[model samples]
Target: MSSSSLTVQGLAKRYGEFVALAPTSLDVPAGEFLTLLGPSGSGKTTLLSLIAGLASPDEGAVRIGGADVTYRPPYERDLGMVFQNYALFPHMTIEDNIAFPLKMRKVGTAEAKARAAEALEMVRLPHVAKRFPRELSGGQQQRIALARCLVYRPSIILMDEPLGALDKKLREQMQLEIKRIHRELATTIIYVTHDQEEAMTMSDRICLMNAGQIEQLGAPGDLYFRPRTVFVADFLGESNLLPARVTAATGDTLDITLAGDAGTAQAIASGAVLAAGAQVTVMVRPQNVVVRSAVEGSGKLKGKLADVMVTGSLTKLYLDALAPGLPQLVAAYPTRSLSDEHRIGDLLELDWQAADAVAIADAKGH
Candidate 1:
């Protein structure tokens, strides 16, 4: 259960002329949880398949625990895999299904049964071992599928959206369960999912892919707080992008004039390079922008509240800039912060700290 380090160099895959994955390179540390996150047709699954030995890479090499496994077949690779569909055998009892992998490896019946029982218990499904897949609920069946993969005690586990079939509450519960299992087993896990929140909550690091290429790879907080590319900023979470021109540059901080309705807002350069007079995009999170009734100080722009959408925990206020050329903006405030005096169409000043604002090159395209 200890061997979990994986490394890929220039991995590429193709189906005829259409490339499934480009030259992708990534390193996953042992006993760490790494998630491949992207939208559909973004090569997340293809990368997982390449790692699992289900599909061959046309270029590059795959190494597990410092050993080359690029050309190895799935069986020879000795990795456990859980698919989105669960892939349980309906005809077999849960116990037997969990024992199948051990049987394939030629383990004795008594030993296989003991291991199967332990695996079932690991996933909290010991009582359902005698039941058939058809008799179990979707979540229970998925647990069985997990048990089957765990019985062999493979060092590396590849899960392809394993909880995608479950309902929202069940999916959240399973996310915690899987994270706990990863911590307890200390196995190297490569998970694939299109859900950003799921990846952010469970993974130690996330590899975001786009159009057969790796867009960015980093810790969830790093990706969220300091994105390198425009696509990463837009895809990972909600952002209010305002056009700006750099007025001054002092080291990492920059004084910029915001374009459109909101007259001018100061921002700091979050990226590696920035020069004075450069056109940039000011990246501001909704939570970072503050809404106030009175203009307390400078760097505040007046805006009219266009709409307010109240969710249980927070309220989202859409504002139209009072200035002629400024763009409309959205701000999210905690429910507790709302006062009885505020109403729709009221004028409010929107302001944000320079440090909270991220400035990126304007030429970077999506």
Candidate 2:
């Protein structure tokens, strides 16, 4: 029943000649919901498996409550895991399925059943305790699986895309459920998913991994607003990266001239120090850009409107700068603001406040 913090020092893995995970160290305070986020083959799951003892690491140590657990077996590590697959027992009733972990440890039938009912109630599915897995909906089955994991009250829970099998609506619904349960239980949870939105919606902090290393790790807004690298900015969300040269550098601003454009732009550059004449990448989110006419004292980027894309509450304006090797830029506007008057081929001016953009050192080989 002890809810303990989890830690890792130099945890890494490899297969043959390739390194799947380089040496990495992280700490998850007790009761924190930490998410491992990355694209496929980015070592997020490999790190999770290492923490779960599902795979051995080439070099590293895992600690729980400040005690060494690197070499411990999964079951003995006091961790419960919920996989993308429901992994529920088809032949057993939901109650038995939830009670399996307790039963394995020689718990009495009465105690296991009581705890199983409690776990079901915790997941808001007490009524489905006696139903078979095949008889429940996918969401309900996943909830049951969650309940099964909680029955043992492990110190930490490792969830690997538990909602990956659900449709969008169901996945979103379950995200709220998982968030509510974490709030209620306050247990340390380490979740692994390729879905960035899910990580943003549910995690207290996000650890974004890539190429066997941590790309950028912080609160969702921190990573999105002030990315330290171009890769981090582009990966977190939609970005309109423009090449620029640092014409002048100050303590708070980096004045740069955009490639293929004559106007100079200023952006926040305190995060990464750059000297004058150094090349930088202007990191601007599509939503932060504004389409308008030429305005004094504003950095104007002129482009022709290429197309419009409407998704839910936002309208995206794709603009072509006609620059060689550069892709079309995008600016997102509120759906309500996009009227019939807007059309393609219109010469429009795009501008963004210097505070809204970050200047990252030009990443090579991107």
Each prediction's RMSD over C-alphas, in Å, is 2.1, 2.0
Candidate 1 lDDT tens digits, 191-303: 99999999999999999999999988999988887777778888898888777788888888888877753556777776667887788888888999888895645556778
Candidate 1 clashing pairs, residues 3+ apart or interchain: 260-325, 260-326, 261-325, 261-326, 262-326
After TM-score superposition, the amount by which residue 153's alpha carbon in candidate 1 deviates from its true location, in angstroms, is 0.8
**Total clashing residue pairs per candidate?**
5, 0
Residue 70 of model 1 has an lDDT of: 98
Predictions in order: lDDT:
0.86, 0.87
Off by over 4 Å in 2: 294-299, 322-325, 364-366
108-185: candidate 2 lDDT, tens digit per residue: 999999999999999999998778999999999999999999999999999999999999999999999999999988
Candidate 1 lDDT at 361 equals 81
